[model samples]
Target chain A: MSSLKKSFNVRCRDFIHAGEASISVQQLLKQMHIDPVLIRRIAICGYEGEMNVVMHGGDGIYCVEINTDRIVLDISDKGPGIADIAKAMEKGFSTASDEYREMGFGAGMGLPNMKKNADEMIVESEPGCGTRVRMSFIIKQSTPT
Target chain B: MVPEYISFVEKFCTGCSQCVRVCPTKTIRIRNNKAVFFDELCIGCGECTRVCPEGAVSSSISVIEPCMKDKLNVVIVSPVLYAQFPGVMPSDVLIGLNEMGFDHAIDLSYYLEMFQYAVDEFVLENRKSNNAPWPLISPICPVVIRLIVLNYPNLLDHILPLRRPVSLLGDEIREKLSHEHGVDKKDIIIYHITPCHAKVVPDRSGLMDELGFIDRALGINRIYPGLKQKLEQVKELELSLFPNEHFSFVPSTRGPLWGMSGGEIAGMRIDNVIAVSGVKETMAYLEKIEMGLFSDMEYIEFRACTEGCLGGPLTAVDRYMAKSTVQKFIKMFGIGRRLPRHKIRQLYDKGWFFSRIKPSELAGVYKSKRKPLTFDDMKKIEKLMSLIHGSDCGACGAPDCKTFAEDVVTEAADLKACFKMKE
Candidate 1:
């Protein structure tokens, strides 16, 4: 089966345009007549990843791949990478500054929420290097009502 | 079958594509030098009717004389109807309807009070139990509900499941008037005096069609001339002539305000309610809600009309003037009656106010049968997008270049329709 791939850029500290990428992806999925439940889950993951990049990571790239069987999202940021991925994955363990926390951006639940929504998630990071997050959502095959 | 509330008169349409630009759902397209309406995509916000400069888009106004002659006609006056005539009070409008050859006229504000109470209770209980979706949406506007059904299906569970005040009032009038007048249930016809065209479709189709509460809807503008004359006559009468009991019952302070934006939430005791009006604003807010935003809000009231029902397409006067009139009437009437908490609770317990609106029922009969786009289709659309100017000029009939490209790729439109491409 043929797959459609799309990419969006997320700039660090650009609060005004942070959610633009996720919203565009959501609209695209809606136009394709994807199941709303699946679209919403994917949107939440996209938004969380986008926000995380803006709040903590450097300028990032968010990409999505869609096919009949499943949809996948890949997000990478060119920022100071996480030193301990295991501790960062834990809920409420945030490295965000006081300013970001005050703005309600760095809630430390980003990775956990993304993991909950995605069928499979893989995070690759190294100190002094950038971070990459990959998430996949299985599309249920059903007759369109 | 979905009732055709809004119709396009081809003779009057100049193919300027004005209606196409304002359509919220992008359902209207210029085809064969005329605008074609796709009924399935329509949410009946009446935006097209409002924007059509040539008056080509007309809302269907039923001829009520036949029903009046055959049945015991009872007119349910919308609060917006009272607001139309500047100096006319709600009671005056009711009297005017009676003078204009109606068996009885009921004030919608009375039921609106009960509707408010029911919603308040529903929100409170839902908050305590955490059983349903948070930030429950108001069910007052039929167009808003239809919008959710068509574009925001994921937010369906957020809609408050309650019958409109008009339906509640219609049910009571039909049941009581038929018995009191010794007429058959079918012999008693209830007509809703509506200010909006969107209200016309729900009575005959959609989730409330099976209830059959409202027999027909009379647009305010259609009946305004005769009703205004009747109200003028009522205005000339002495103020003290009517007996004390006749003017004893009045709607609550906040009920009449339901004709304007932010009125529904004003009546509720809850503090976390947000009221949004206008079709575009409502759609944007719904999109935000779908993205899991606004979690703290307990309720949201959305009106498809810009300034609420006062700004309805069928309104007789300016929306601002109508709003001022309603406000003046409210102030003069002196914060009218309030339903007792016990009474409201009893009705709530009996399930008198609840409406069973299934998701399937809200999904209109004409569900779009278009297949989901494949990767190849997407590629074709992208290619078409690159070939055309993205200025979003309505000369191509579609709202924007993206929609035009999609239409062309889907074979719904000819690629040559793009004026830029021809050049």
Candidate 2:
């Protein structure tokens, strides 16, 4: 039942530092002897989630919890929350602006890509309060061929 | 052939560990007050050749001699040769090479045009094939191919199984000359004049083995002095005729551009191609590819040098200036010639484009095992990590604090080794 945890502060609109948190998490996962395939899933999920925070969220905190059995990521932001959760979760649905798109991101695929990579995803939001996303990945019994 | 393309000249080596710090593969190590290079771990990227301030590192190439009188020597020149001098054209360089003892000199761009057609058809067919891997990596750069085979063996199938243009050209020239001159193939020695040190390495094993026709590699820098002298001697000759083109040796518009960075991607006609150059950047990109981060990409062109072949450590010209010179050549006479697509397809179907990259013995040797730290070991490492400043200053001789902590656990070093902590 022992667990290891780390938290990273992600500032909104910090485009330069957008992928820094995900890269840091990736290095940490590699150091922890996690399966490479599992690490990749976490990296993609962490990256998409981190980018969402940088592009849309106000100041936010990205946290990670890992144990022998599973890995979890908790991303919470103080930004305006989505009104239609179903629509936001749609594959091509995006609220990101043209400026973000110009930076080769915000293709409306972040949330869906995150969902595809993670084993399970939970989203909670309030209209003007904030948005929080928790993603969980189960440790696989064997490496996928 | 020498076992290694690069070696440490111990007389000048100061054991500064600069090469170890920059090596992507961690092949260089400080041992007994000198640098020891592990050939098995080296990818031959020439990063060590560039970083060695004491001139301790030398890239070995076969020396050219006019004394090999029994054999007809033909030099296959890279486009980087044209980029070397300010006003010199590729034609001038080739003519000078001829004056310097070569029976004839030809450009690799000629074969590159043929190669591009092969690539276009391969990509189109590969998409429809049942199990062909997407994001086919270009195998043009030997160093990049070696890096993948040695480090990312899983992506080995992803590489385009096409013989390098230079090697393909060797086969072509040897065959054509044997028929045209009524000479034996062995009597015709085809030398590749290259800017890259990696190009000189004869494949003893692995994917690029059995390129027997490519007799030797002569470095552009090694031949610079002799070529310069020949250039002076050939100053009165008409350089505009393009002698090689008269013999049907010419390249397409994009052929010469392959010598510069981003050129291969520009030539790839496919969308979502990732072109990366320089050792460190290519290493990072390869890691991403290994992680499946670039699954959406259709192709990747990885070059070890900063600006492709033009930025190779064995080059005589500055990379920036060389790139501009190549661009100027493209503007004037770049559209030399191209074989028709049908003709190229015929060659492709004949299996001329096919090549193999065998897995390296070093592949997965270091990465397959994921060493899980015990609870006690983690606690010990955490304690050691906490005692030092978190800044990743390399004063401890390790790359960073985490590696330092890992070294402490492995009993390779101690905490007092951190000079920053001592301060």
The best candidate by TM-score is 1
Q: Write the per-residue lDDT of candidate 2 for residues B1-423, one digit (tens) a residue.
A: 112878667878887878767877656655555776556767777887888899887776645555268887887887777788767756677788777778768777767777767777888787767355667788888788777765556566778777777777777789888787888888998787788877746653345442586778878888888888888877887665565542435434465588888776675556767778887788777766654567667778889898798898888878998888888877886454456778888888988788744333424533423255643455567677788747966555665677678767867566677776666
Q: Which residue pairs show collisions in model 2?
A: B207-B357
Clashing pairs for model 1 are: none
**Tens-digit lDDT string for candidate 1 (B234-280):** 78864442212322234444555888899877777889988899999
Number of backbone collisions per candidate, in order? 0, 1
**Range of the 10 consecutive residues with the lowest summed lDDT in candidate 1 chain B:** B240-249
Off by over 4 Å in 1: A95-105, A143-145, B1-3, B62-70, B202-205, B209-211, B239-249, B329-337, B360-366
Interface CA RMSD of each prediction in angstroms: 3.0, 5.9
The most accurate candidate by DockQ is 1
Chain A vs native chain A, TM-score per candidate: 0.96, 0.94
